[model samples]
Target: MEPALDDIWREVHLDGLKPVLPLFPTDALSEQSDESELLPDYAESDMNSAISALSGRHCVKLENLSISFGSVHKQPSWTMDPTALLDVLRQNPSLKTVTLRLPIPAVTVIEELGDLSRLERLEMRWWKDPGDTGTTGDGTTSMELFPSLRNIRSGKLSTFRRILSYMSTHLITWLKITVSSFSETQELFNMIQPCSALKSIHIMPIVPLAPTISDPLDLTLSFQPILKCKAMENFFIHTLNTVPPSDSDLTSLAVAWPKLSTFTWSSLSRYGPQATLEGLKTLSANCRSLRKLDIPIQVPPELPKQTPHAPFCDGVTVDIRQWRVDDAVDIDRFVGYLAPLAPRDGTPWLRLGNVKAGVWIAVGDRLRQCYD
Candidate 1:
């Protein structure tokens, strides 16, 4: 499968993942990979040297490993022959999950990796090194690579999208993807539209190659695409780069995925209008099977009018962490509004209560006081 122009594989170095020492320059991390002539994480060694290190590993049988190599200032000397890498993988047939960050055309890498008979999960990222080589459909064909693959956690859109096209979508049940742009988000939804069997998807905003969180995404338009995967249950987004979702966005999400039990999107922007109590009431009315709710919403000032007609989901922990409160708020008023979400009696044995402190701890304290 031919990847898009932007998703080139840069580096996948498995440097034994040894952390650099205290004397390592912290300043190199903040600089973009291209700008940093010699990244602190990479030892100024060549590809043969990296592979030799892997050859000397302590484990005779390997299960999972992540190896990547790339930099903007990559020299002509930073060469890799996938033949050597392929030989190494051939030795370790027990490898079930393999993460590669390499500076080569994905076509060459995937074609070479077709020999790996037992790899089940693949994590691939393009590191933007000078080593990549390909033209349109150059030097590769549609050979079924990673035959046993199921789970895929890709850092680049092209990497995941290309893999999905080759594999049987029905086989994949879980996905943890990091999308860097809105176009990437919408495009990914199109890819998952056919993933009817996908049970859980964890979406993240930070790009693996860069140090910064991507530009803010408006949830209204951005989230509409993935609603096609009706089988989703544990829906989560590490939405640090997103504009705090409006109430409409919240309810639309709730109504779309009725099966969601462990729903969470923590650390929203402190500024902007937050999702309010009324919005949450609508959420409770629509999606009743909630077990853990962890969004930042405005807690009401007084006893919220929880009518007899209101939908209540006891045996749940609404981990609305550290919410913004104004005025002298009575604790009872807060608990009354949140009674529908209180933990059911005898449910503490599960220990599903949130560990986050600040506002939610006090509210969780009230759940035992007023509802229990």
Candidate 2:
């Protein structure tokens, strides 16, 4: 097989060999170790050979390219030098997406990829290194290098920041970031404030592996900065710590994103910044395009006091946590009175109830299914 591979390389045409899956049949079983037999086999040498054979295909149009590097025993060893990646990109002028894993020394050299005028999406994953500072310099970040980029997903917060630091905010429409541990969320919002074209953002903050205290750290989460990105359609802020928003916060959000269709503000029910029914009403009234609303609400004692009107709309959804469980306020009677006011159509179909089985179980179920 080695002699045949050498013979094939010697017969390359002027346009170079066309790229194909390098792992031939029967070779997969031989490549895996006893412990790794259950895992998908990777043929690094074969891939490199195939890439080398196609090096001359300068006009090849590839849609996606995935490259990884690390110790073969402890990690997947698909490591290629950034320069080699650049060479591949240069050869494939029509490349649109690149997914990279692990760290590439002097990765900033990738800035040369500005030559790939058609590149649009860049995804980097499994970066656990905290000391790797690629191109996060003090200089102003300019997205001109990857002007065509629309979506970016990064596993490391530092890596995400380093890449986004140089990108023009207007070119990015979608960003999904998972950070290891951060003291606060203020810095994140500050960094993303310039992203005028951002439409959807999903941020997940993980706990730090090493902590100074034995107890869980308390962190503050704020979404006020998101108001600047008026083009936003969906914003998911998931955190391990509870950070709820207040009625005023929701009103501010309503004003900020009048076009918001889907939103998830975590810890609203069990945490701080608790909102009232009025805030939800304000959100529904302002976000005319809103279809689904999920938040934590403190069921007010005043709910039974309000007049219950009949349905107003045909299709809207609302999900909330019934934070308060008061025996005085009968769940059935309370929901019965508010059902009329809980209209569908332009109105949201509110899913409100407590986390545990409460008296409102039957009422909440009816509310969630009433729109149907």
What is residue 303's positional error in candidate 1, in angstroms? 4.5
Identify the leading candidate in terms of TM-score.
Answer: 2
Q: lDDT at 332 for candidate 2?
A: 60
| Cα displacement (Å) at residue 189, model 1 | 2.3
Model 2 per-residue lDDT tens digits across residues 190-269 = 66777788888887765433433443323324455667898888888766445466688778888888888877766422
Q: What local lDDT does model 1 show for residue 364?
A: 61
Look at candidate 2 and tell me the lDDT of residue 76: 43
TM-score of 2: 0.68
Stretches of candidate 2 exceeding 4 Å from the true structure: 1-59, 67-84, 128-143, 207-221, 268-273, 301-303, 306-314, 321-341, 344-361, 364-372
What TM-score does prediction 1 earn? Answer: 0.65
Question: Against the true structure, candidate 1 has what lDDT?
Answer: 0.58
lDDT of each: 0.58, 0.57
Model 1 alpha-carbon miss at residue 43, Å: 5.7
